[model samples]
Target: MIVIEGLRKAYGSTPVVDGVSLRIPASGITSIIGPNGAGKSTLLSIMARLMEADGGTVIVDELDVTRTKTDLLARRLSILRQENHISSRLTVRDLVGFGRYPHSKGRLTPEDAGHIDRAIDYLHLGDLADRFLDELSGGQRQRAHIAMVLCQDTDYVLLDEPLNNLDMRHARGMMQLLRRAADELGKTIVLVMHDINFASWYSDGIVAMKAGRVVHHGAPDAIIRPEVLSAIYDMPIAVQDVAGKRIALYYE
Candidate 1:
């Protein structure tokens, strides 16, 4: 399990993640959902050790994220951030191959190649594997990046807004892929998402943040109620029992 204690972040005097204490289960999918500037990305980055926290501690499994060695943590956890900018000219295959670096140390073995090929197939990048990152469309590029994260084969996977830039079909596909990774591989997958419906459908647990604080965390049904939705997003939200699941409707 990932345990967080007194996690806090601030910009000047404004606290973005104010005293967040959370325990993300060791298995299954957990999605962090919130509005813009709610610090969802900031919280996720801190958990993944991509960014530093102002105060508090994040412990993944038994390893303290702040103190663990980078390579050791990389072996156990892998993160794909929301905004990925690359200045280098590299093909999809080349980029995904980099995911194996922690294990192979820049010298890929046959096993590493096998894992890379499997990840490419999972994301349906066979057709575009040879194409440079600059050549693919935004959604396709996003999938390539996802494939890299999965190729790392870490037990804990954190994706900051994996659905961004994806079309409806691809977005659903991405969620299902993560679902399979969690259930079948026994991986713990945590994601930051803006689309509430997607998070409600695929996540085992939902963490709601607002104004730098975790206002609530619970199962999908518990967190999807009208009151919870309305309070979290600061909008009128109505939930309906649709096909046995609580579906939130916020649009007027």
Candidate 2:
């Protein structure tokens, strides 16, 4: 389990992630959802140690994120941020190979090659595997990045706005892929998602943040209600049951 205690970050005097205390379970998909500037991405960055927190601690399993050795932590936790800027010209395969650095140390063993191939196949990137990162479309590039994260094969995975630039088919596929990773592989997958309906459908737990604070955290059924949705997003939202799943409708 991931334990967060008083997680706080600020820009000047304005707190971006204010006193967030959350316990993300060891296994399952937990989604963080909120409006823009709600600090959802900031909170995820802190959890993954991609950004420093002003005050507080994040403990993943028994390892303290702040104190753990960088290499050791990378073996246990893998994160894919919203923006990936790779200046070097590299193929999709080359980028995915980078994920094995912690274990392979730039030398590809048989097992590492297997992992890279599996990850590429999992993301349906076989056709684009040889293409350079610059050649792929935005959504395709996003999938390639996710494939790299998966290739790391860490126990914990954190993604920010993973659905960005994805079409409906691919977006749904991404969620289902993460769902399978959580349920079948027993991996802990946490994501920052803007689509409440996607969160309600795929998440075992949904966390709602607003104004830099976590306003709600509970099972999908508990968090997907009309009142709760309205309170979190600060907009009128209607929820309906479709095929035994609660889906939110914010369209006016």
Candidate 3:
């Protein structure tokens, strides 16, 4: 389990994540949904140690995230940021191979190569494996980044907007991939997303935030309610059971 306590972060004077605490499950997909500037990305960054928190603690299982060694933590958790603008002109395969750095440390063993190949094939990037990142479309580049994150093969994977720029078809495929990663690989997948419907359909839990505070956290059935969503988003959001799943209808 990922345990958070009194976590806080601020950009100079204005605080983004304010004393928020949460417990994320160990082996399922948990989607963090909130409005823009609701501290979703900041909180994820703090949890992954990508950014320093002003106060409080985060513990993944028994290991303290702040105190753990970088390499040690890298082996247990991997994160993909929402905005990754690395201008190195690296190919898809090269970027995915970087994920094995924690274990291989610049030397690619046969085992690491196997992992690289598996991640490429898992994302259906085998055909474009040799394409440069700049050579692909935005959605394809996003998938390449995801492939790199998945190639890490860590127990915990935190993704900030994994579906960004993806078309409907690609978005569905990405969600299914995340589900497979959780059910088949037993990886703890936590994603920060703007799509409530996708969160309801794929994740085991939904964590809603607003104005630097956690408003609600529960199974999709509980969090997808009209009142709950209306309160979190400050607007009317009607939710209904469609087929066998809860679907939100917020668009007029």
Name model 3 segments beyond 4 Å from true: none
Candidate 2 residue-wise lDDT at 23? 96
Q: In candidate 2, which residue ranges exceed 4 Å CA deviation?
A: none
For model 1, the stretches where C-alpha displacement exceeds 4 angstroms are none
Tens digits of per-residue lDDT for model 3, 174-242: 999999989998999999999999999999999999989998999999999999999988899999999
How well does candidate 2 score on lDDT at residue 49? 85
Sorting all predicted structures by TM-score, with the top scorer first, yields 2, 3, 1
The superposed Cα distance between candidate 3 and the true structure at residue 250, in angstroms, equals: 0.9
Question: TM-score, each model?
Answer: 0.98, 0.99, 0.98
Candidate 1 lDDT over residue span 1-252, tens digit each: 999999999989988889999999998999999889888889888998888999999999899998999999999999998778999899999999999998989999999999999999999999999999999999999999999999999999999999999999999999999999999999999999888988998899999998888989999998998888998888999988878777788879
State each model's C-alpha RMSD to the native.
0.8, 0.7, 0.8
> Per-model C-alpha lDDT, please?
0.92, 0.94, 0.94
